[model samples]
Target: MLHQEKISVRQFTILVFMYTLGTSVIYLPSLVASYGKENGWISVLGSSLIGFGVVFILNKIAQLDEKKHLFELLEFIFGKWIGRIISVLILMFVIYLLATNLRQIGDFITTQVMVQTPIYVIMIIFILVSLFAVKLGLEVIGRTSEIFFPYALFSLILLIVLVAPQADFSNIQPLFRENIAGAFLAVFPASEVPYFQLFVFLAIFPSVNKPDKAKKGFYIGVALGSFILFIITFMALMVLGPDFTARNQYPTYILGKKISIAEFIERIEILVAIAWFFSIFFKLTINFYALSLGVSYLLKLKSVQTLTTPIAFFVVILGIILFPNIIYFMDFSQFYWPFFAITFGLFIPLLMLLIGMIKKRKQGNGSQTPS
Candidate 1:
């Protein structure tokens, strides 16, 4: 059966905020710095505006029929066959997205923390935790986000403040080092992972108990997410320099390592790691929930939570097989994934909005016609 669960506006806001931070906090600095160099901050500022537009488009699509979600609207607007085909494509993309994220956490833990532990072992543990959340449904997920959000926010803020003294403003000077075009180029890679990938929220929008407040919350969440991204990017460049930031896979983690206040408080990269874990955990939970829920809706299943186990098994396999190593993953993300993301993130939702508007106009004309 379709779920009747509802999350408060506050819960929804936190979900969006945490979701926007997602995997971007740790990896985006390197990704953007590699392209924009000292101008990575510029790219972040530019892309966040695009992110706002994207949120507007996604919300418009979701609002087309307040009661029907993205999946049902696909069928309603496109007819059964085309809609189902599109649904299958989106669902497949979600699966891959989930696997990519799972693989990221897996690689991070194995390489950085667990050392000798095999990657798959880490993947299994993380996926199982997310799968447990998926089984519990979005209400639990939203509530959990609320509980952890305060700590995540506080810890992240502490990290930034502690590292602030290390920042060398000179490192960010000579702005637009790559000229305007290169900085603009950086925005593309910077935009894809965090902003475009947020199409997942379209599926969850209808679950918010307060639609009006949730709309405001969506804008707030995106703005806050983009701001945090900018601060982290700017800080990374100033403290570590663009080369160091770009070269290091997890520059934010290194910023944590740089924290030495009187040498009394040191090696607190754990704070960054812990805060990241909360964001990624929620990210994985939301992605997995979307995957399982999308599958249930596509198959016309009665219950949304039924497919968590079997689907997660495939994700674990793909999480391992899809990414051979960090090099391949980074290259794919920079070179190909941005375009891959917009296909769903921008074009699909834009298509939905246009088609939905057209349909509404036609219906209005039909209603006015004499019987």
Candidate 2:
């Protein structure tokens, strides 16, 4: 039997919330504004329902096998070779996600703050920091997220509070304009990425102390995270209006730039940037951790620690390949990439769930006693 670490439900919940909210909070508003116009918040709220529904389905899968990771469950249902193939595909998908996110962060920092620095340098630094966090293991990662969660939330709220004076609610008037279809389309990427990515949590199920509470915690974490995105999206539209937001690469950052609580307290975008960095840091850490854990399970490695460095290197390479330049990356994200995400994140998992259910019924509902 593989030895498993234990983590509290609260810790797990915070980890999921932080992981879900982290990168999405930075890009979600701008992405949604592209379609929803002034009614982006409606799309955010609407998409969150889809996000939560994905979480609920994941939770149901987890409940069916108290201690088994999704990969193992897949093997049980689909037989060894096919299950291993699925596991490898899932791992590749996660690696792709990690790379894409790293590229986005690199692009953001390079274009916005560090135009002089080579993008590779920034990517290396971020990956190294995340790699170090993953080496400390999931318990440490969970605790770190718990500590930083408040600051992330505070920075977001502070942005809203400071920007309140400049906010023109009129910008969001005539809600639900003719772009209803387009608005929902915008919500798909933002909602699906964070929400469906919770499938990675299936890798960490054995580490959760009270396995039964996994469902409850997963739901709560995703809901809270989605709500945060909704609020931030609404604030961005209200503060900057959809037209300006869609034009800006980082609408949330622009919202921060607009804050001025008296002349002495201006240029607070740096503070917001710092807060956002931590959020992204936690997010990268979670992704790296998931990658490490998944690899450890697949290869039968005794410890996830051994795989972190090599995997971080792998991620850096992926980041480089993900985009020739920021413009190309953004264009891909806007047009082609979302359908791909839906295939791996939603369609694959749903198919596996059905297969697992049928396999269980064929086995006469016999529960395999844990060894």
Q: Largest lDDT belongs to which candidate? A: 1
Model 2 CA lDDT for position 213 = 81
Please give each candidate's TM-score.
0.98, 0.94
Please identify model 2 stretches exceeding 4 Å from their true place. 1-3, 365-371
- Give Cα distance to truth, residue 352, candidate 2, Å: 1.9
Tens-digit lDDT string for candidate 1 (17-134): 8888999999989977887788878888988989999999978877787777678889988889999999889988888899999999888888788899998888888889998988
Candidate 2 steric clashes:
0
Q: How close is candidate 1 to the true structure, as a TM-score?
A: 0.98
Which pairs clash in the backbone of model 2? none
lDDT of each: 0.87, 0.81
